[model samples]
Target chain A: MSGFTVYSATGCVRCKIVKGYMDAQGMTYVEKDMKAEGKEDFQKFYAANRRQIFRGPEGVEFPIVTDGTAIRQGVGACLAYLYAGRELDGFFSAGTLHKEWVDGIHAAGGNPAAGEKFLAVVRLLKGNNFKLVVDTYGRNPALLEKLLAENLVDVAVMEVMASAGLAGAIFGQPLAQEDIERSVALVATAPEYRFQTTVVPVAEGGQARYLTPQEVVAAAKLLATVTRSKKNPYLIKLYRPVQPKDERLGELAPLPAAALLAYRSQARAYQVLAEAEKE
Target chain B: MAYPSVYPTGVTIYDPKKCWSGYTIFQAKEAGALLIDMNGTEVQLWKGLHGFPNTILPGGYVMGHLGLRNNAFGMQDQTDLVQVDWDGNVVWKFNQYEYIEDPGEEPQWMARQHHDFQREGNPVGYYVPGMDPRVDGGNTLILCHKNLYNKKISDKRLLDDTIIEVTWGGDIVWEWTCSDHFDEFGFSEAAKNILCRDPNMRTAGGGMGDWMHVNCMSVLGPNRWYDAGDERFHPDNIIIDGRETNILAIIDKKTGKIVWQVGPEYDTSPALKKLGWIIGVHHTHMISRGLPGEGNILLFDNGGWAGYGVPNPGSPTGSKNALRDYSRVLEFDPVTLQIVWQYTPKEAGFVHPPDSNRFYSPFISGAQRLPNGNTLITEGSGGRAFEVTPDHEIVWEYISPYWGKQMKMNMVYRAYRVPYEWVPQAERAPETPIERIDVAKFRVPGAAPLGRKKETAIEGTKPYQGSTALCIAAAEEVDEK
Candidate 1:
């Protein structure tokens, strides 16, 4: 018996896409249309596993696939699982830069085991000559140092939370200022690397204000110091607080493109790159 | 990133069997108070009755404000607090609190009410089986704004919070102002200095210091603690939380003194460490006597930013000092401060840290304990309301369909789940089970294609070791510059 069961609904373009992708891959599976002949069966299935349902902004997504061993809700999550271990253009790995400290960060409920697994995957990709991209907060200097020394990562992006002094609060954990400085220095040594910081309104005393241009320049100065060059690339991306999540942040008007351009001009010590302006 | 403009609204998911099914009422962002059924049907709408948060009283009566005050002279002031019958006729009203005059507008009596108020019968504004809010008689506790200055708390004119108990005849029989208890909060010298200088100063009302912008207030009602001789949890004592100061306190009804409290400093205690720095909190109250975890404090820890403290690197002046990225619904023993139960991203079945924001509402939200073991949460910032079982399974969910014209967003201040019988004006809709739609398969017509090209390759490019264009958009952004 084929273990795959795709619960789809009629008129669902994603259903068609998922089925088409499966057919393109020569995979066989049963397609049950919840809005059509398979409605009753889907209801029964939903009743049995309602708690496992993942409801998004729209509703329960369609083309839910069950492989006997696992259930995948979205097309992206489903295909990623089905294509696991299959060849791809490259591998993207996170949670590896701070192997040990990953367990200490409470904000994301740190998982050292998961960090180890991610590091192992990076090693597997690099050992097999596959390209790798590493995105990190750059909290752990020694691990980053090792990763850069081994030339294991092709492209590395360090999300600079703040200048050395203010980073601990943003990270939700304190680190020696020297450590943050060292991580920036290590990331600078990568074959391809850039430092990015999302400019958001910092609320204090019940009011909010965006990080001043001088503050942005202070970050650029950190990059300049670490790379020992005025040409080190620094990106200032505007913060977009997703609703219901960072709605309070959403209430604050975003820094206009003109304001961002002003920051870029002020931070002349580094190659400052601004995010795409909101239309 | 641009978000999808089109998505499902109204009742997205409903499991009637698991939910404490009843009429869900809230102030729609557009105008008027809307009472929606379990299936998202509009059972009734009181068109001209606005709500900072509307509450449904028994016998088909709803209480809200008549209209809002002009922003030029007031921050969140309402014209009057009124109770309207099923047909939207004003039954009981109170507006004799303060008479205000704004330049270019006629001077009139204003209630100055903003966030919350509770009729005598129910301790919390929400419904309890045996504790329905009296429709005709009983005192009402109103959270109102009063512009004053104490120089002790701030140098600027302060938009201070004051709780008043008015009789059925609109007489202000009792009153308690927040600034009187500033020293009770145990602020450090640095915190005190910062507060005296800023006090959460705002531009509203021509630059007023909105010190201790208290967002929630409720009575203790009859509870196990008071029954067991805890005078601090006296049935009549009031509970209030300051959004700007990070303080949840209970005021003695008789003495008007703070009898019990938490914060301004949360990191010092072990019990507080369980739920760190509940900044910008709301809807704090003792769960009514009959509900689960009765006598325990239930509050929405609106984790955004709040508090006063010493200068830190992130906040140089220590104004609005505390911060957290996610929200949590906490039920804790007010005395021991032991967290009894909570709902965070983990309970919502999302991984922590990364998916934390999936369960956040930084400001303006609330929670209510249900008769069953579930808790109804109003994540008002997103205009989302839902009931979750004690195990944190979301049994029913509703997203507000009304978006405000001026705000251009649907943001509910608070929502309450009341028994269906409370509003007899409309017949209860069928408790149908609305299954969660497959968001993956759900689509808006004329939307972008669901499938991308199998290969988005830059053809004939020279290869380099470990080279991949994962962030093609970022590359484009750099090229644009």
Candidate 2:
């Protein structure tokens, strides 16, 4: 089982970091949306999740992840567990988890004992494990295209970070409209891909500061124009505040489930397969 | 699909710096009341009948309703409220409307006690040791519901919520009913109109309307205000919240009058304006004295399906969408009527709009004031419980791994943090401090291959991590700045 479950939420910088690290190491995972279908929905799995991870003492937070038999939770713990799990499972061990990741999990639920225990118990040696998502193609399109061309990508994840021209606010810089469109055309048109929008409610001083859900839908339709096939799965990845010295950012919330679903339903009208990946 | 066995399971989270060290006791859906240490380890369990909203007595005894096999929507139509020891031994028991029995121990019987209860012997309860201390009466306060049809109170048959004080010998020492003071709830013209037309207290299954489903009720014990001679804040007064009508009130147990209240009309008061719209609230109680921030009213503001304002007749017949959908934990002073502190998902670094349903649980959940000045919260819908410091740092967190047998939902009604001494055990486990993780630097152990699969033995993997230069098209080095 070379695959892991990427339990991620939108606007989660930790999720993005995990994605980057996974990309660098060539490790694959199945990105499960906490928003769309939750871990709780599957009762048996949830029961196992508790029995396996919680020992009546510590627990990992969101971005809870697992590679078949080996599971990790919280951003830091998941990463450390994943790193240690991969190496102990004998599939891969070249990439070293950052000391910070290991330390973070230790605090968040990842201690050395837990990391090692997870490795010993996880049997990621068999399963249809594949690198789940490949991200933000608009910012790193060329890198994503190369992965696709070489068939390294399973579900080519194209994150629509922002709706068209307003993308600069989220990326912290300007992204040319033409470049974003061209990238979407190239990546979304791939044989197999997932088009997603990490919808965040831009907030400043405890107030919303961005496009409304309807506007996002309009923008989503604009991006959907590039998709050559309606079969390409479309997603509304609900946003969370990404870390990086933006006090206003953490205050910025993900759109409400109603708004996200509204966006998804409207986006579906544009002939795109839409689903909500809320946290 | 089977989940990975090695991933983070439902472990208990304890951050020494933030959480108050204690044993958590809760009514697990299947296993009755469970007493566990902070690390998610089960210290003890009482596998007797249990239902939602269970609590712990001073000496590790557990009190909760016994769940049934075919309860509606997992709703507890509990025939009895039982108290058991750590070993699942039924120490004291009370079956509602029938008899109260402590067969093995004392062979005592009393009036049928039901819903919420607090014994005078328990310190993990409303009455504290100091401040406005009173004599130990060895009595218990209980919340009961009995159907009464009085056209004056309501045209339709109503589920009357009654609060009663009963002795261990089963004497109903003092009692109060909803219909007796139906005029005291301060129902607005609109609320009155609606209630008069049809209380709509009926459940979805066409059952009797569960009007004023009083899930919790606690007597305001000794506090700074009461000790200072505030007759209204007298130790014996009671506080309760109605889930259906969206009202929270403090009852003057003496005069049998509502001394202070909020709701039935929030838009009219300026103080309430700052308090925000509290919908379908729960666990509304005065933080007992001797605890940090004692005397303050703390409640879990469940922003679920509840209302008093249904567009007011001609204003616009709004659907359920008119209601707000978000949950909050609020602590405020009853004197100044000012919000002392609040915890929304915003405190957890979540912004609304995108994470709309983030801090929301329309139905079940609760909050508790910790001795360490922190607040413990349980998001019942998600079955997650956590403790946040006064400044809102989650020092500890836990997810109930137990699923509800009847509802098949992993919803934990409530959990309380009882100090280690509360359990009559010889030894207690030490707690460890967990560091928050850094997701940015987390890593997996894989390295992409340098060349084709035939070269590395695996048929086809990606290029090596060191060879990103060879895959320039996909791994472009864009200046993030």
Candidate 3:
């Protein structure tokens, strides 16, 4: 069939947004509320593709759009495919970190082809009037500068992966501090920007330790110095390792809310983002 | 038939030869103590009789509580611990433990009994071949709650766990409070700081700090360790585990001091390192003497959230400082802290990595070693109970069909398997082995057939002629131009 099916639940805000966008665009599709009239159909569909469904902490994600062969989950991916004709896999979206692009860069080994392909996709998406949001780890300074110079990104987010002592655990290979500084400086030039760091457990010498309050402060100082603005929005997100890639990091215990607040308090140089701003 | 039959609930699998066939008793979430035989046939059910856990005594006697205190006054507080015979007559009762007046409620005595209790004859409260629980007379050791404040534990009022042994005539014979031995728990300075401030405070009991939230407690009973000069594993020693604190400790009945323990910390030794962090654990007990793995410490190491320590990314508050996804049934040498036998997903025969969570229950579960060298596991959070042999082959399985109206989930607090002869009032059901249903084939009536590779047609569009794939390709082609 030419149309796709959108599986949704009641009171799901993102599901409503996607349906609204589709309606305004005059798109023809079927809507299935998993809890109500379409429960049986969803169940049959779910049973057939049980292994493919992504089960996260909140259980199954909603607004699942299936076009027979390819299944797009969550509002981000559904909108990306429906609006911009971009199929995303593994939580890929315009707003989140560009992990797929980073993986392409890693696979290309200093080749410019990966960068050109990404820029092309960005242009294609921009042509569709999609509000572009990008998150980067700042591994490639020149590429980040190019994106900023082109004025292609609406909102830019730079994620500070780790503080000094914990960098080796987070970054697989050594990333130059100068490159990170350049990327941070470039990211600030965007219309809307945020410096975010997710406090996660880092394994070193068979032991795991969380980024201490002092460590978080060091990252905040770096961001402040690079951007030359204490007003820069910095978000401290507590990571919940539901299914972590690193097995050793899984052994570490979860930090309590008090410690996170303590970390937020210690980073006086950084301007904290409100809770609603968190993903 | 009450639920969607994605998979059948009662008796999905049964292997009578491998399983130690018995009458499985558990408190259905709706209301009642239900006894099911080997075939998952409902043999008997005592309506209106509920329990944090319903236990079956010898000679057809069922033990449970009649009612629960309002959540506003107490967390999981039972009003009266009572026993009833085959005809549902209250044979014995106890409630004179604490007297309190909840807001807008009458002042009355509350048993305050919560997670667990054990009678004198049976050490673990479940059945063992030679040691049947006394139906006529036996003192009851109850794991109850006591609302009190101790500055050493926290500044707020503490909902501390208190073990009390009460006679058949409802007289308190002995008592031990958890907060009294707080210092002996060996909390680090950081953990202590967090504890003093929070103590895992809950809104129940008008903002009481449930510091130790001890979920399970039972007497050690006759053990090989005790017989071989390990005074710490004495027959009368009480074993209890704190759900909030990640501690499984034994209390000396005479002195009421913590003598043997395994967490709040697990890395103190090499053996404990292998055992890992036992967080949010339950049903910690020494295996009864007649059981195969007797003298070993058995517990359902429910690896969910618990403990106090330096905050990591996962636990932001540090109050519930530890976190893990999978559950493990661990049988270990308590003295050496070495894991003797374990039932993780690996043991449960899952092939893929990270499959450990497939056999997990984050909260409210238990393990019992049976006479036939098999273990009956109550994966309570999912309302599933199954029997596993020494090889970890699931010989029998049953999922509880009774879903709670208030909680909106089918969660069994605990389950116990007693010998068929114990409940002679009901005839034993014919033991028919039910094979595990093939999930791929099971489907609701009139639903689409599964595993067929036919293209699914989207509504409001013609099938095959203008398909979704072609539509996506057409859109992509337009973008490319």
What DockQ do the predictions score, one after another?
A: 0.00, 0.00, 0.01
* Candidate 3 CAPRI grade: incorrect
* Segments in model 3 whose C-alpha atoms lie over 4 Å from true places: A1-279, B1-5, B351-353, B448-481
Which lDDT tens digits does candidate 1 get at residues A36-77? 998998898888877666554556776688777666654433
Q: What ranking of all candidate models by lDDT puts the best one first?
A: 3, 1, 2
lDDT of model number 3: 0.77
Share of reference contacts found in each model: 0.00, 0.00, 0.00
lDDT of candidate 2 over A187-272, digit per residue (tens): 76555666677665565446756456566576567665765544456677766543435465454544454445445545655534
What is the per-residue lDDT of model 3 for residues B1-481, given as tens digits with 9 covering 90 to 100? Answer: 0334356678889988788988999999877999899887888899979877899998889999999889877888999899999999999998877665778998676789999989888899898888878877878999899887899877999999988888776656577889989999999887898899999888986798989889999989898888999899889999999998999999998788899988888888888787889999999999989899898999998988999988889877688889887789999988887888988867886532234567778899999999988999999888999999999999999899998888987888889999888888888778887877777777779977776677786779854542224423433243355
TM-score of chain B of each: 0.92, 0.81, 0.92
lDDT of candidate 1 at residue A256, scale 0 to 100 = 57
lDDT for each residue of candidate 2 in B1-481, tens digit (9 for 90 to 100): 1323332335445687567778887777676677778777788777755745577665666677654322331123455566666666666654423122222433222223344666764323532334321222366677776556767645777767777665554444566777677788877666666566556456522344566777778878777898887888888788888877778988897777888788855777788777878888888899887778789989888887665446634325321212666788889998877988999866666544234457777777788887678888888776778888889987787877877665686677787777776677626877776665553443345845344656545767676663234433211232121
DockQ of 3: 0.01
Quality of candidate 2 docking, DockQ = 0.00
TM-score of chain B of 2: 0.81
* TM-scores for candidates 1 onward, in order: 0.59, 0.53, 0.59
> Which TM-score value belongs to model 3?
0.59
